[model samples]
Target: MKKHTYILASLLLVSGIALAQKENIKRANKLFKMKAYTQAAKTYETKERTQEVLQNLADSYYYNTSLQKAIETYRELFVKYGDSIDIEYHFRFAQALKGVKNYKEADEHLSKYYNKPVNTLEFIEANNKITPHNFKLKEIVNEGSSSDFGLSFYGENKVVFASTRNTENPSYAWNELPYLDLYTATLTNSNTLINVQPFPEAINTSLHESNAVFTKDGKTMYFNRTNSTRKKTDEARIAHIKIYKAELINGEWTNVTALPFTSNSYSTEHPALSKDEKTLYFASDMPGTFGSFDIYKVAINDDGTYGEPENLGETINTKHREQFPFISEFNVLYFSSIGHQGYGGLDVFRSNMVNGGFDKPVNLGNIINSNLDDFAYVIKEKDNVGYVSSNRTGYDRIFSFSREENPLTKYLVEGVVQDKNSKKLLPGALVEIINQSNKTIKDTVVGENGYYVFKLEPNKLYKIRGTRQAYIEQELEFLTGNYGKSHNIDINLESLVSVEERIHQNEKGELHVQLDKIYFNYNTSEITNEAAKTLDVLVDLMKKYPSMKVEIAAHTDARGSEQYNLNLSKQRAALVLEYLVNQGINKNRLKSVGYGETRPLNKCIKEGICDDEEYDINRRCEFTILK
Candidate 1:
């Protein structure tokens, strides 16, 4: 009986220990759900490496941008639970890999998650060559603040930014930092913050406030205000953010109110005002969004009311988070996105306004964008200066940058193809840029606007050749200089009819090189003295317009056997092509064909069908411009 008692006691002790561990895991899960990643990670680190625990732990490190730990944990998770792990983990794993510049491994996982091959390295290389600007960034000095971002220009010399420097406020669950507040300061020439002061109690509430934008007059400001309380949603308890307007009247800010379109169920934050103060752009996750968040714009009416908010469309939004939009004076839309091809977490992108709509976004490249989150891009187009936020240093920090035209983008040539006489746009004209080595470097067909552009290199000589069917080719040679130089080489191509009266457009709209009749030896594919003289005129015309491509077609009379005539005509056409090639014309620019008794000038399809004059009309060579 005593022995049985001992066994029961031992079992009871084991049950109690197991129950305690279960309770601890439950608490950790609750913290994870609350976005208390730091604390949850610590708790999960002490737990067993179960699938759930490992997933949560890896996610915690990833969300915190502790990438090396995230990578290690994620790798372990896959090794232990590769079969049961969700596919979403692959995307996170890829991002973690990219965070450390392991793009090769990251692409493997990204390819699986996206179900398509991903080449991030190539994208980065190409972006570097074509991005419009190269930035020189300097980290702003904030002596005491560990996390601060979203710096915006306020009036002439002042700047406003969001900071977690308010230690008095309660800690945020996401990063355990203090709740964010709006702080204003005068920016020094050395990019240091001076006289930094938080906004009045009205604007700097206990809740998170950030991403402030002010009108040019500095009388009105729009900013983000996080909900004081969390509301239970299907996914989790979310504290939705709303855009609030604060009016500065008589030197005091008052009349603070949330925008009517903002809701407690969804977030609408990161306000940016257009130059005219007529449009208010912000980021939102409201209904009809293409992703977790999308950039939106609303018309601020003259009566101080706003029109319905409009999504920026798919060109700017993607199936993942796209936020922190900033519009410059030039009407360029600068935003951050994760869904579009990027290095890793949110990379800053720019999209120019074309035809009154935003074009496809271009990645800002690796200079200002890092593998971690970089956002809140604001710039002064005239000054070529800007401020952007990035978390590459393990904490969100603000950077001031001075930009110059990208050297790679500078050495380029652009212009329109036009008719020499009418000055009308020549659409569908082929333009080729050839290097000093006589190799065609690039080529493009002019669009409806007749515009053509090609990127070139510095200290190099290039020739721009413009050509269209039956048009006199134009070639202009230009040399590029260093330090971001661009040249406009407008090509005015002349028509063949304008230059050569012999060239005529046939009824079928084919341009024919009409030459005097040539007499050839009977049933032979040889060029006679008379034929040489006529071919010389054709060669001179081809040399004058080097871009022309011509087809040499030979026809035969129907008197000879059909097969014999076909072979003779083919040989004659080939001889014409060879003659042109020997006369310094590129062989690639000529084609030869024989239409023996198949395409007669007159209705003489068979032997003895017509007189000799009619047969002679069919037995001739024709030169037609192909391009």
Candidate 2:
């Protein structure tokens, strides 16, 4: 009986321990759902390495930008639960791999996740060419500063930003950093910050504060602050952030109040105001959010009340985080997104307002973006300079940049292809742009508008060629010396048949090179002197249009055996292609075809039926434009 009681006690203890672990996991999931990744990660680390626990733990690390830890945990999750894992895990795992520049491994997972090949290195290389600016980063040094971000224009020469530099503030559970406070400093010409000081207590509270935007008068300001009390939602307790408005009166900031749309259960942060101060833009994860967070805006009425908060919609928001919106004076919307395709983490993107709606967003590219969190982009269009915050160096740091137009995208050549004699748009004409190295950089068939455009690099020589079937190819050679400029070159293609009365296109669209019949040694495929002279004209035409692609076709009279004629005609056609290739035409531009006696000219059928003059018409060489 004693032995049985001891066994029962041990079983009960094991059950109790299992129940306790289950409760802990429940708590950790609540914290994670509340965006408290740091705390959730700690709790998850104490649990057994089950699939659920491991996935949540790895995700926590990824969300916190602890990429190395996330990679290791994800690897374990895959090894144990590879078949059961969701497709999204593969995407997150690939992103963690990219954060460490392991592109080869990342691509393998990305291919599986997206169900298509993804070449990260190739994308980075190409993106560098198109990215608008190269940034020279300088980390603003502030003594005793742990982390700082969200730098914005204050006055003529002053700057305002948020920082967690104070040790006296309460520690934030999100990252173990102090609660953020608004701070001001003098921005020197050298992009250095000096005389850094915190804002008045009215603006800097015991809770978090950040993302301050000021009006032109510098007297009105809008900023973000965390709610003092935590509100319980269905999942967890959350201290939601809100935007507050304050006025600088009599050298003091007063009348601090939260905006009308702010809710205790949802976050509304990263406030920005338009140039006229009539529109307010912010980020939120409220009821209508399509994802974790989205950019929103509202109209500021003349009476100081606000209209309904409007979500930026699908054009700007995706099923992932899109935040840190900054509207420029030119009405360009700049924001950060993790949902869009990027190098890795949050990448800055710009969308111009067109037709009174936001257009598609364009990634700022690799120079200003890294494989880590890069957000809080603010720019001054007039000065061609901007400020961005990034945690790429392991701590949030402010970087100043001077933007110049990308040389690769600075020059462009655009033109219309038209018939030279008719002056009418020639749709479906082939246009190609060649570089100095004689390499075709771009090739396209003109649309209904007969238009084509090629982005070019500055200080380079280029050739633009226009060609169509039965038309003599025309080329225009020019140099792009002026950067950030557009050049127009209209192309007019002349008909080859019009230029030479003997040249004609058959029903199959092949341009025949008609010449008087000359006697060739009974059966040799060698080029005779008369044929050489006739072929020289084609060589010159090919040289004039470098991008022209042509096929040399040879036909034979229906006199010899079919096999014999086919072989002889193939040799003759090859001879013509060789001649053109030897005369400086690219071999790739020339192709050879032999129709033999199968396609006879006119009604000439058999050797005995037609006279020599009639049979001679069937023996010919033709050149057809392939592109």
Candidate 3:
């Protein structure tokens, strides 16, 4: 009985395989025709599936859905059979690899056919994050209007966008696009916008026109337009739109024309053009879409026309529509979408092509995106400011976003470097600025008067190394905390160490330490935000050597009453000492000292320098380590 049951089960399995085999070939062909590659791929996977069936299975799955499975099937089927075929499958298979983010391998294959442009958007974006700060956002591009969309650099001249302005319905509260057209504003050489206006004649139609990208040479333009509508044909229900391109001939734009490879029955628009005018990105609801209106890329062929569109894949697309693509000069793609998780409505996002696939798309975040509809953004290379078109305001307007480049401290570092021997200013010496990470962040040549200035955030340890060829390098460290008062700490560096003397090695050497000056504001004990930043540098060094003791001192320029100045300086030093104590430094290791008018370096008419700024030279405070 057990043997009979095993035989029966084997028969059933064999019958199922046989049934799968016969129709599998038929199903593969049917799906190939209908472009349902993913569903047909399962049947074609059986061992009994025919060569004709599996080859079609590979092509269908690969081309229609993605290249990952297509590569596998093509490699397997190609191995089984030599390359005698009715169609060129390998070329598309390579493009499929590129479509799926297997770029290096795809490039290996693409080199056999095409030379890809160098994508530098990733580098541009990386440096965008690596560099310093940004200017503040100032004003709106449009004070009124509610229909602006899509912004582009107008070829070293201005920014062009889509708007429903100054059109028919001139008295209408708003001029929305039925025949929407191109508008522009001048962009200053510094990337500022001015003298905004609209493009006339050929570029502007009575229909919807947006998604404009210019060729690098600035003579050609590719954009989207709604040609005509069809009724319920492949997701178009008398409401489908299309895309088009136009050329700037001589000094005028030619009439717009529809793009090639678009079917009459499907909805397509939102075109993104490559800098070389050879590649494009557009949105379509064509057959075999992974989700609603997936983003697709197409390459320009030898004849100067577009090839079959390749879907950008699931990485940058979601079930929601992704449109208005902007490929930065560096190949970083910026697009707006409703699909991915966002704060609300549509948000602008940027993605970089990395390792043959895309890095995760980054939400330009709250700084650029708003809860209301935000779309159509373009970034300037090597700049932190970008222009975005949105209806976030009560009306449609262009908003400029100033991106903060770095998040460092905010205190100004000002001091003088003097020669220890003659107490004369050292002119033209390089002042090297070092951050806490020990990276040489910046270097400035000292002015002819031997003064240097640097700005940093409060709460950091900075090392200032002053140098000249004939003189030994002099290094000074400072911890700037929250001191409400101004600083007048002038540093005087010494000569080259004498050969017989390892002077700096012995921390106890006389010239090893000296106080140039102490700084304070007029009658203030509260620390300024600038002082807070510089004090942090001091905190780090003192913590580096737990046994070091220091005296916090205050001095007054020779202008005030002797007794009052002494008390005021003492109170000021005590306030600073209290701050250090609160920062966890031992109180027993610190002392407060006040030196009134008695220590003025400059001899004055009445034992003081005569003028306020010079008089300010003596009113200061600082810390000196006591060995």
Best by lDDT: 1
lDDT of 2 by residue, 7-86 (tens): 99999999999999999999999988778789999999999999999999999999788999999999999999999999
Error at 304, model 3, angstroms: 0.5
The true-versus-predicted C-alpha distance at residue 375 of model 1, in Å, is 1.1
Model 3 CA deviation exceeding 4 Å by range: 1-139, 169-179, 187-197, 233-237, 406-627
**Candidate 1 clash pair list:** none
- Model 1 lDDT tens row, 503-568: 999888799988997655668889988898899998998887777788999988888899999998
**Model 3 C-alpha lDDT per residue in residues 1-627, reported as the tens digit of each score:** 999999999999999988976665666556455444565566566645456875777776654434567778776766676455433454455545544445555445445444543222243344334223443543354533446667777676567877666456222211222346777777555545467666666776655677677877778787776654544533223435677778788888885688776766776877777666678888888877766777788988768767888888888887667877777766778888866544444677778654444656766655465545567777775576677776555345666667764443246677888887788898867787786657677788887888887765455577887775335567788876542223444666665444213223335433222233335677766777676655666566557546557777777776768888788888888987887788888899888998876676565424343877777877777565553
Model 1 TM-score (2 dp): 0.68
TM-score of each: 0.68, 0.65, 0.43
Which window of ten consecutive residues has the lowest lDDT sum in model 1?
453-462
After best superposition, candidate 3 residue 594: deviation in angstroms?
Answer: 75
Candidates' lDDT values, in order?
0.89, 0.86, 0.64
Estimate the overall C-alpha local distance difference test score of candidate 3: 0.64
Off by over 4 Å in 1: 234-236, 410-627
